[model samples]
Target: MAGNQEPLSPRARLAVTAGRAAAAVSRAAGRGSGSVIGGKVALRLDPDLLAQLANHLDVVLVSATNGKTTTTRLIAEALRANGGVVSNALGANMPAGITSALAGGSDARYGVIEVDEKYLDTVARDVTPKAIALLNLSRDQLDRAAETRMLAERWREALSGTKAVVIANADDPLVVWAASSAPNVVWVAAGQEWKDDAWSCPACGGVMQRPGDDWFCGECGFRRPVPSWALSGDEVLDPHGSAWPIKLQLPGRANKANATTSAAVAAAFGVPPQTALERMHSVTAVAGRYDVVGYRGREVRLLLAKNPAGWLETFSLIDAPPAPVILSVNARSADGTDTSWLWDVDYSRLAGHPICVIGDRKLDLAVRLEVAGVDFQVCESAAEAVTACPPGRIEAIANYTAFQDLRRVVGN
Candidate 1:
């Protein structure tokens, strides 16, 4: 609802108005996915709402285990160089949010969509985006139903003949394998910080071994594909080895990779490196991610780590030990029903650090921290924990639902 550049006809405007009305009613009733429900209502009335709305719009669909929201945000921001971009920054990847996002904008020239991993194939088949950026893949932890390898296979099969160009992280073998399925792909040498899930060759089911930075499968001779764009150190390097300095408002190498990923996709869409870098560096946060908030006279920098892989990636960004950290967990519907993934994370990395455990699954985290010999105290909420921390920028990490809960608590 933030950007709308085109004017709609009387009938189309009425449909969008009806959808907005539904969204207002849903929000007034305190319902989740108001945008989704609103979009659904609009779709019910006009079955081809998204197709008609985004008929001439250049669409970029993004999917991965993590970094979908932030990556989508970066791409959208960069694409603004051309014209308005209709995007869903609400962590919504399904029909409802995608519909609202595509239909809400009347004049935007592009749509940057962050799709849910499970729904990627379905969404791609329907929308036929201009570019599909695959960040990386790992176990989502709570959903034991779908496997990562199978998802890649499905992606390959689904995109076999699609017109969209695929921009993928070559460091992630699963991503490479999946993106390779598409007829056209622009491989990116974006490093994969986490490689545990991709130990097996997605092509031949052979064992994959890393010899230095390159991966090769022994049994089937499958190997890494050459990348057109590569992230080396703090620079995004092209195939000719020309480097573009990556200056981001976000922290961590993971984020640098994300910015580079966005740059690569945007460049493929014809945005200049200088312009793309400027737009991407302007983003300090995406939704609630990496937001620094003031609550009860303490500064709490919020971070989200939903699974073991996410925790492993996030820990690299937090200040080292003894700095007093707040760790919150939850097992609600959005946070996954299983809290067992806590055991999978290497909280031992913060072995000597002081951590204030909070949330519905704080006890579970406490037990895991205790087993790792971490110093911790239980608090009623993340707000309380941050308030009790030392007088400095306090680091607070949480799962999906708990992250949202912490924001509400801190806001009040």
Candidate 2:
């Protein structure tokens, strides 16, 4: 209440107050994990609450099928140089979360909000963010988001004729197609690890061939755009051919890619590359995505992979065949009720590997592992699975709800 950043009109103030009260009650009653319920109540009380508060803030919007939460946290941390900032780092990325973020006060000059892929068009219209980052788009929540291509088209239409600066990943063909028509844009080859989704060219709908970092469409002549920043092997290279070393505690090339794009956006807002990277290095985790937790007197490292793309990228970071990690999954609303997407993932990669299968969908995972000829055990509890695993830094990979369940049980 003290850090009310945006001076409000009487009507907006009433809505913010109502929303804050709802959030407090939810937290007190242990019914809601965040301000989502409160945000919804506020929106209903005042339909234009988002636009009313956003009018006074210079904002940056981050959209991605994956990594939106982590990338948003990175940008917000780097912008600490600018003073106070408000962001939805807790995974409340829909309209409700965005509204709740703005409703909470702060004179913070810049607001970095994570906009869900499905709601990018809706939130962008209200915030009119000064800068927007379109990270990679891949199939996720097919039940809710429809298709990846449809989401990209919506993004293109939403930003049409807008004055905001757009930063896009040139490595993802769909991302390139989505951001192509923006009035102003900066492209970054932020190192996409998943290639199966981008094999088909978005332009001609023809098969694409990747000879190296660039993909070419033989039919339509659409090729990878030359990027202003290139993320290669632990370093991001600028247009001047100078390499900025990437040093991070979070393992994986995907994180390096996240850092690369965040630094690029920070520079667009006048923050130096070195300074941005420095701030980002301090980020150890984002809402438990890659967090280490102490559970039952042992360390449990959590990794979340919602869909095929995320699973593919995460697997590339750590050895699977020999590492002996626990795999948890559940068919909850958070992780689309449909478990059909599991087939799209390459489970054969785990053939001959040892793994522990848990979560509500343990039967499904065990069956899949059976087909792949992988050696695995079935467990009902994450605690029991950890005990069965070999000692020292046991890894636990899960879908959305299973990951949250771990967070709650592990006391995060």
Which numbered prediction scores highest in TM-score against the true structure? 2
Off by over 4 Å in 2: 1-6, 320-322, 351-353
**Candidate 2 lDDT over residue span 1-412, tens digit each:** 1223456778878988998898999999988654899899889988899987777677899999888888899998888876677788787989998999877635666788999899999999998898999889988876776687788889889888878889899989888988987998899989777776788888778999898777889999888888998798888887678888886777888888888888888887778778888888888988887788876666778899989889887777666555668889898888988887788888777665467899999998788778767788999888778788766666788999998887787655
Global Cα lDDT for candidate 2:
0.83
Could you tell me every candidate's TM-score relative to the true structure? 0.94, 0.95
Model 1 clash pairs?
6-107
Give the Å shift of residue 395 in candidate 1: 0.5
TM-score of 1: 0.94
| Tens-digit lDDT string for candidate 1 (384-403) | 78767877777888889898
lDDT of each prediction vs. the true structure? Answer: 0.83, 0.83
Clashes of each: 1, 5
